[model samples]
Target: MAGPVTAAVLVIGDEILSGRTKDRNIGYIAEYLTAIGVDVREVRVVPDIEEEIVAAVNALRVRYSYVFTTGGIGPTHDDITADSVAKAFGVAIDVDPRARAMLLEYIKPEDLNEARLRMARIPAGAELVPNPVSRAPGFWIGNVIVMAGVPTIMQAMLDQVAPKLQTGVRMLSETVRADAREGDVGGPLGAIAQVNPEVSIGSYPFMADDGRPNTNLVVRGRDPAKVAAAVAQVRAMVEGLRKPG
Candidate 1:
């Protein structure tokens, strides 16, 4: 697009903050968005509080191209994401007929209790993001997309929402095994990085299978030519530094 298509993830849940439930959506969302050319710039977790959710949503929506929220739209008192999102956008929220209809696919009319009805609340002027795992629909309002906290449900929502988002150029990456300790290559790597400012260079240290310290140097950039050039420089540097057994 005009610039990089960036996104922020707002994870809302008391269980996540309390550690009772481990979060599994952030990484998945980040990787998925990256593959689709949307850079995930930030991630924030908030307890099930109205003010915190509102503030996070408002701030992130303005700062990034898209905001994806996970959790707090369930059938309980603590599930307040829909209402908080409505307040953030200063819009009215009510049980949307379309959402109710979707829920009906799973829940019989008599079984759709008051608590379950909470799942149908959607902000005005918002579009629904369907959950293939569960019938409860998430929503997209302005630049924010609210989704279920459950990993499977959230993933389904993202797939439904992906085709509609504005995307940017995909990043290209190259990895070279240094077969040497990270410390051994830091200087040369830093020098390469300084000259190739267009590409990002990173070193990941690991223990080689032969019981020696080693590093993997990664070069990444949106431009293929820049990434290739940086990779060539890194390969030459590593070759010159190779140690004899």
Candidate 2:
């Protein structure tokens, strides 16, 4: 059987680090990858510095099956993820014919200024991750996948890249609504989690619509049977806690 396929997300933008742009890409990428049997294990937000982007990409690309970076691929001056990624791989970069053609599809030949031409520059031997929303394409070199920062464009690029990625057994999760606080479930849940070594048990505390304290006991695992068993344990515990003393 194939082992778990894992990935890391490298969010590249000065706005993100400065708290100017509320990042919407990480959550979307994580959930999207999870549904497709790819586990996103690490997420790092970095400034728009070329060195930082290169360092983060190198670090994550080696540690995970894939490293996805969103941001810094635009036409503006701060869009340096492409160059930094190329630097990391020690590869030459230039305006690729394919990316340039894609840009021409959206922009008139007469209007393809130098600023817009910057979007077509790709690292040597990188495969373009198509952008359906906008013609500007992202690129994938080895295990590192570069994408746009814009949520809509990034999602479109991911759609093009997903078919090429390796997938593993999809993680299955079951949630048990525990009408109790985390404190009530922590101990028993901890014990249950310790016994079920392969399953992940998490307790999320929230308020109900009626304003009552509620906890959600989520059991996640690759095997449905194991998840079901863990959920059964949680349900039994919740039922036991509700019974009058």
Clashes of each: 0, 0
Q: List the residue pairs that clash in candidate 1.
A: none
Candidate 1 residue lDDT tens string, 150-228: 9989998899999999999987778999988999999999999999999999999999989999899999899998999
TM-score of 1: 0.96
**What is the lDDT, from 0 to 100, of the residue 243 in candidate 2?**
97
Q: Root-mean-square deviation of each candidate, in angstroms?
A: 1.4, 0.9
Candidate achieving the largest lDDT: 1
lDDT of 1 at 86: 99
What residue pairs clash in candidate 2, if any at all?
none
User: How do the predictions measure up, each by TM-score?
Assistant: 0.96, 0.98
lDDT of 2 by residue, 121-173 (tens): 99999999989887999999999999999999999999999988999999998
**Which segments of candidate 1 are over 4 A away from where they belong?**
none
